[model samples]
Target: MDLQQLRYVVAVAETRNFTRAAERCLVVQSSLSHRIANLERELGVKLFARSSRRVELTSAGEAFLVGARECLTAADRAVADAAAATGVVRGTLAVGVIVTTAAVDVPEVLQRYRARHPDVRVLLRAGGSDELAAAVRRGDLDIAFLGLPEGARPPGVETLALDRDEHVLVVPTGHRLAGAARVTLLDIADETFVDFVAGTPARAQSDQAFAAAGLARDVAYEAGVAELITRLVARDLGVALLPSAFVRPLAAGDPELALVPVADGPRRVEYLAWGRFNPSPATRAMLDVLGVRGADPED
Candidate 1:
């Protein structure tokens, strides 16, 4: 009936509990219940089926929830637009970044953004490239920095090439292979390797490199985070294939770690992804700061 009633229904649908929804909405449980009841009465349909132990949405409620959430999102965007018109970018921007990128430049990016627009709020989450891509597609992330799969394009998001990071071999400085100028895949095929988990873009690139060299790797360990893999290699657990940026900080501080270039390998490409439709002005500004632009004039 009204925005307030719709807000109450949406909150209850999300939390699936009257008390918890009321708490999140910053209202008393009794008031929230009254509002929801009035809304259901006006609509002549039950939104939620309730019992002493739990609650569940009715079929109609499940269908209505999507529209309710969209309405609230549009309302919030409208407010954000008005604020931007007054030279203030004030809204929550959810950003997702891969593990390595988060460590490399994300902190500096956020610091610059905060200094420029203190009113804008940012929520940063870290995950693997696949997970971050899924969040961007699901509208959970306003933008993301992730490795795009080879020949894979996101459904409703625009992609811009950010930067390329070369794959390299990471080992303890005292290891025999550490002195090599450029190591080929065959050189380490028999060595115990720390590998990225399968089904990720990084793994795909690494696999392609091995396949190109007419070799196969013996993976002794697998990890999700590059820094963790580096730590394992530092402890002499196993050598790892990692991006150049991921090894920079550790190589600077720890003299025992050696990063050797992998010759004749495919470079890892990082992409800046944002929803194609309904991107906020604040998001565009951040992209400008990230130095992403349209295709080069020569192209």
Candidate 2:
């Protein structure tokens, strides 16, 4: 009923646990639970299904959370507007990034952005392009770095192309093609493949390339993170196609992993994407500090 109770509901919905949500909200577990219980009693609907193992949102919780998030977003915007009137920028800048940005200069940009606006807190989230872009579209994230095909980006999002990197073939050092000067999709078509889970930008681009070359690939295993894919390759489980900047840097640490040029493989463009009318003051400041180039996305 109250704003604080709504905040508690939103936090618990996001974290899926009372203790962790209470910690994030800077309150004790019992107090947060008491507030939520009071709200549930007043509403006369169960928000969450409590279990010893995990918490799941009930039907009412799912419906309540959507409105709760919008209310909080509106309140946040009002507070930000008032702060801006006094030339004060203080808020959280929620950012998302794909795994490959480990090679990019994101840290430098964030450090510099914080130097200019010390009161703004930066929170980073990591996921594949599809997940991160979805979060940006839903206003869960203010901005994100993602690998995407050049053709289409998500709706309600503006994009700034940062850099494009080619995909490379990853093989264990002992694989015969590891020493080859050039490799093609045809050469690896029949080999067992290790790939990212479906819907990731890397997987999409790789699939496109294989299809364009008129070949079918056998994906033997799928992993969520780059490290797992490389480890599978190193163990000779299967070969994989990955971003050059993402898997290439592992050469120094993993001597068994060999990164080879994919010889005209697909190139994935990295982008900084945000809501078209994103109004976060800290987000605007971060954009200025990064000086990332942008143009209106084609519909």
Best lDDT goes to which candidate? Answer: 2
The TM-score, computed over Cα atoms with residue i paired to residue i, of candidate 2 is 0.85
TM per candidate comes to: 0.86, 0.85
Regions of model 2 farther than 4 Å from truth: 12-24, 27-62, 293-299
- Per-residue lDDT value at 44 in model 1: 92
Residues forming the 10-long window of minimal summed lDDT in candidate 1:
290-299
* TM-score of decoy 1: 0.86
* Total backbone collisions for each predicted model: 0, 0
| Residue 247's lDDT in candidate 1 | 68
Instruction: Give the Å error, residue 214, model 1.
Output: 2.8
lDDT of 1 at 77: 87
Q: Residue 90 CA error for candidate 2 (Å)?
A: 1.3
Candidate 2 RMSD to the correct structure: 3.2
Residue 257 lDDT in model 2? Answer: 82
